[model samples]
Target chain A: MAMVEIRDARKVFDGGFEALRGASLDIEEGEILALLGPNGAGKTTLISAICGITQPTSGTIAVGGHDVVKDYRAARNLVGLVPQEVNLEPFEKVWKTVRFSRGLFGRKPDDALLERILRKLSLWEKRGATIKSLSGGMKRRVLIAKALAHDPRVLFLDEPTAGVDVELRRDMWDTVAELKREGVTIILTTHYIEEAEALADRVAVINRGQILLVEDKDALMARMGRKTLRIELDEPVAEIPAGLSDYGLRLEDDGRVLVYDYDTSAERTGIARLMGALAAEGIVVRDVATSQNSLEDIFVGLVHDGQEEEGVA
Target chain B: MNWAAVAAIYRFEMSRFFRTLLQSFISPVISTSLYFVVFGGAIGSRIDQVEGVSYGAFIVPGLVMLTVIMQAISNASFGIYFPKFIGTIYELLSAPINFLEIVMGYVGAAATKALFIGVVILVTSSFFVDLTIQHPLAMVAFLLLTCVSFALLGFIIGIWAGNFEQLQLVPLLVVTPLVFLGGSFYSIEMLPEVWQTITLFNPVLYLISGFRWAFFGLSDVPVGWSLAAIALFTSLCLTAIWWIFRTGWRIRS
Candidate 1:
């Protein structure tokens, strides 16, 4: 069975705001599943529901085969959440906060394990420092360390690098990679496609409270992805000529370039036909190139598709 | 129940309480001393006695009860409210513990703190007046009940309050006035018959009267009624908290 299973999870908040609309997914164990979405896309809501912070308006979520609501203790015991908010006892030292979190989960004190996790996060040096005295990046690391204190089966990082600098973001990515290598199941949500591309084995695109798609990152990019063919003419023109008007290609670089978007999977790409038509129109080509869409383009397209669905519904 | 979880929360709150150790210890002692100077010395000189005890001694139970109840509520309310304010409450909510365990941690710590402050005030009061506990066992019972009950009420208020202002609203606007009017400093017998009957309705009056009875063996109402009143309030607070946790109201949503 999947480590975490959310089926038909729907959260209609007060006054009919559908924060989550029948979202469902199965998270495989021991893999980093990045939930990719934009703001107001229900990423935080999903984590909240799964972590037992909030109940689903309707649906069932199970962690390690334990239902979050019916078997809350068992389910919550299997997961730890690093929330987007940096909400710690400002007066408490970092080490004590982490130790307190472990105790809260009914875990016996293991100073050795705690030390290892803190050191891994680069927070060991600041263990005696009060949380409020640390920089924002260090505080974020403290939050992560606290979540890991219980040695949970799954760790949910909700927008972990939202406000982090580039250097800290890179550090966080390295930490996540090392944890994944240690056989820990990590689930992170972010709008940064770069983070997802760098870390996630599988990516789930969520928008408007629904999972747009959940697929292996490579398969997702290869399937929904579109390829573009561009021709740079030998001479510049203002617009496409009448002879090539039927092809309806995009004109850019002062009409010096012609771009055609097509599916790579299709047998007839129309690239050869387009090139023949351009030649017949006496348009000389200086250079030819094809570019596959990056994950960012795919993410934007998915969000746009979800918006169109939002408009329709 | 998870004893470790309860202990964790309890210790965390206690550590926070001690972080302001200087102020926590000094403020109550200073305030009790001032009350003694004003109510016990300046005011007592004119009024010889109430119920055959010296004015200074008569107000001892009243003053202790006042401090214990207020301390219980404020400490418990702030204990829970700060976590909510800072968003650390999510960590608690997502943990493997239940609501009862959470309460045991917060309310337990609050009661302990209030009890500690009550003892300090009692010692402080002893320096100012020749006070005696006629029934030491009964006094401890009364003190414990008052501490736990008020701490529960504070927990409810902490969860119900949206901001810091609301956290203090009840203790300041409702509690202080009730304690002052509930025969804390004076005998209710001094009031007219109709007013005396009216004063019986104040819940704090029962706590003060029962507590005073423990001290000098004098009370405005029967000790039984006072004990019953505490039990009733305790049950009410429990029910409110149970409902809050069940519905996941305010905290969950």
Candidate 2:
């Protein structure tokens, strides 16, 4: 069963800009769901709606059986949000900032538990230092520490590694993995396809205020992914040959490479027949290589398709 | 009523307050003392007394009221503005606490800071000239009420403001002028009859008059009327804040 449910949630900002247009999805308990989208694709808006920062223009959201609008206190208590920005109180000490966050949720003070989280994030040594004195990466870690201070059942990280260095991004991924191993339900939004491919159990694609699709990570790759066979010709052709048109072969690399896009799931790939046809057409193939479409390519394709649809409208 | 949340926010604000401890305490003390040297010394040597009290003693309540109002508004405005500027307000909004608790945390801390500054100014005033209290409880009440009301007004300004210019606009343009012209340094009676009536229309007059009456047992307006004016102002500020939160104006969208 889904742990959090959003029913056609729509978030329209002021000036009639619709950030989320009937966007909906359910997050499973203890699973990491990565929401992938381009800029202005409503990724952060959807998270903000779930976290109760940005209220939905219409529809409803429930977390742990509590409605976000009617029963916000209960719903908010069940979720922790590490927002897109590292916005810690500059003058506040690290431990105190976390303690205050825990207390803001009406929790009793637990220094020992907080200390453990600090150590896990590697922020233990800087616990006494003011937030302004910490480095950018450490400050991001502090944001995560504060988010987990109250031990929220569900956590939302909006672009957790938007501007972080590669090393810090890797560390953040490890920390997220550790949290998932410990039974925390994590939902994060990112435009980085590689991160989503690496971290998420389920991936949802959103574009232009709509969720295009949501599916298991590996399942989605295998289902939508296709391989392209590129044949490097020893000679260049100015135009497509009439004989090879039936095989869906296109000349690329300025007519020096013959490209054939074929699905891996086909009962018979027909590569041999296509080669024979190409040879019959007197197109000498010097070399051949097959490359699978990556998640990155799929993301660009989906976003491009969405824009084209909008342009037509 | 999430008391823990209120306390948490309040403590964090106070921590920020103390982070600039030397500046907060010393600036008020030093500035108020300058009022003694310039206004009290230079002006008092010419016209020594007003309303049967020495010139130095006469402006004590006015100076304290001026500082308290300004400090409360500035501290409160900056308190809420910084969080919004840095985007940490989303954390507070997403927390399990309601809007009222958030207001209490911020306004309460701002009021407390103003109150502390008021006490410090009062102590500094005592060193320059003698002061007597006719109604100690009323004086304390006026001091606290002004702190809270002005802080609430400042909270409103902080929410309504979109930039630094708007943040300092009202405190600099409207509030300080009202306090200074409303009879902070000189008594309303010192002006001509027409000007005295015009000055009575200034809302700040009632606050300073009531506060002065607490110290000297004399006022330009009846003490009851002054109390009524402030009570009305406090409720008006409260009503404005309550409406702002209900509508989620500026703070929510």
Candidate 3:
């Protein structure tokens, strides 16, 4: 069975806003799944339903083969959640805060385990300090330590690096990688495309309370990812020549560079034919380079496509 | 039963109570002592006794009931309210524990805190007056029942309230006035015939009268009626709490 299974879950708030509209997904054990979406795209709502913070209006969610609503205790016991907000008791000590989470999950007091987690998150020295006294990054670390205190089988990190600094964000990525290596099933939601690109085995895109696509990160990139070929010219051109007009190339950098976008999966890229046409026109090419599109481009394109579909609907 | 989770919440709340020692422990003691000085000292000299007991001693149970009710309500309300206000309640909601365990932890701690304050006030009252407990067990029972019942009421209020002002609305505007009008400082027998019947309708009167009977073997209402009144009040509070949890009324959304 999958580690986490969500089957056609729906959430309609009291104000008649449908936050989640029949979203379904299955996350395997020992792999990281990154949920990417725009704001209010139901990424957090879907996480909330799985974590039992909010009940779904319809359908079901199960964690570790136990239904989240029917068998909430067992389901909740196996899952840990790190919410996006930094909501800790201001006067609470870091050690007590982490220890309390373990106890809340019906776990016995394990000081050794607690120590290991705090140390792993670099929170050992600050364990004695109050939450309010710590820096923002340290407080975020405390949240991670709390989530790991019970040694849960699956973990959910909702926008974990939303406001974190560059150095701390890198540290968080390392922590998540280490957690995955330890065989924990991790689900993360992020607006930062690079973070998802770096950490996820599979990527799920959500927009407007619906799952747009769920596929292997590499496969998604290979299937839909486009490549750009940049041709740097030895001499500037006022306009595209009559012979090169059929190639649909864009003149950039004050006409010093001609850019062509092509699909990698296409059988004929037309790059060679374009080169011949340039040569027939007697254009000298100083240098040539090809670059693949980053995940950001694909993400933006997907969301934009979703928006256009909504507009058409 | 998720006892570890219960204990975790209980200890966390108790630690906060202890952390604010001056406000939680000392302030109530000092305030109760002042009430004794004003009602028991200044007024006791003018009025010799009520129902053959010294005026100072007669008001002891009433004063303790007053403090216990307020403490129970405020402690439990604040215990739950602060978490909701600060948004730490998400952890509790997402935990493996059920609502029963959540209530046991919060209400148990609130009752314990109120009981402690009640005992302290009783001891402090003895220093100012010649005091004796005719039935110590009954006194303890009354005190315990009052703490638990009022704490349950506070828990409901905490869940119902949307802001700090609404949180304090009940304990201040409703409960405090009822306690005072319920004859906490004087017996209903001293009131006119019509008003005595009116006082009999006040729920807090039964608690105070039963508690006074425990102290001095004297009560404005029959001992059986007092016990019955408290039993009904406790059951009502429990029912309200059960409904709140069942419907996920205010705590879950």
Per residue, candidate 3 scores C-alpha lDDT tens digits across A221-255 of 99998999999999999899988877788999999
Docking class of 1: high
Task: Name the DockQ score for candidate 1.
Answer: 0.86
Mark the 10 consecutive residues where model 1 chain A has the least summed lDDT.
Answer: A304-313
Using Cα atoms, each model's DockQ against the true complex is 0.86, 0.75, 0.90
Q: What overall lDDT goes with each candidate model?
A: 0.92, 0.91, 0.92
Q: Candidate 3 at residue B19, lDDT? A: 86
lDDT per residue for candidate 1 within B1-253, as digits (tens), equals 8899999999999998888888888999999999989998899999989979999999988888899999999989998888999899999999989989999999999999999989999999999888888999999999999999999999999999999999999999999999999999999999999989989899999999999999989999999999999999999999999999999888987
What local lDDT does model 2 show for residue B116? 97
Runs of candidate 2 exceeding 4 Å displacement: A231-246, A250-258, A271-288, A310-313
Q: Report fnat, model 1.
A: 0.95
Scoring only chain A, what TM-score does candidate 1 earn?
0.90
Candidate 1's C-alpha runs over 4 A off are A237-249, A268-286, A309-313
For model 3, which pairs clash? none
lDDT of 2 by residue, B1-253 (tens): 8899999999989988898999999999999999999999998888899988999999999999999999999989999988888888988889998878988999999999999999999999999999999999999999999999999989999998999899999999999999998889888988999999898889999999999999999998999989999999989988888898776788875
lDDT per residue for candidate 2 within A93-137, as digits (tens), equals 898999999999988899999999999999999999999999899
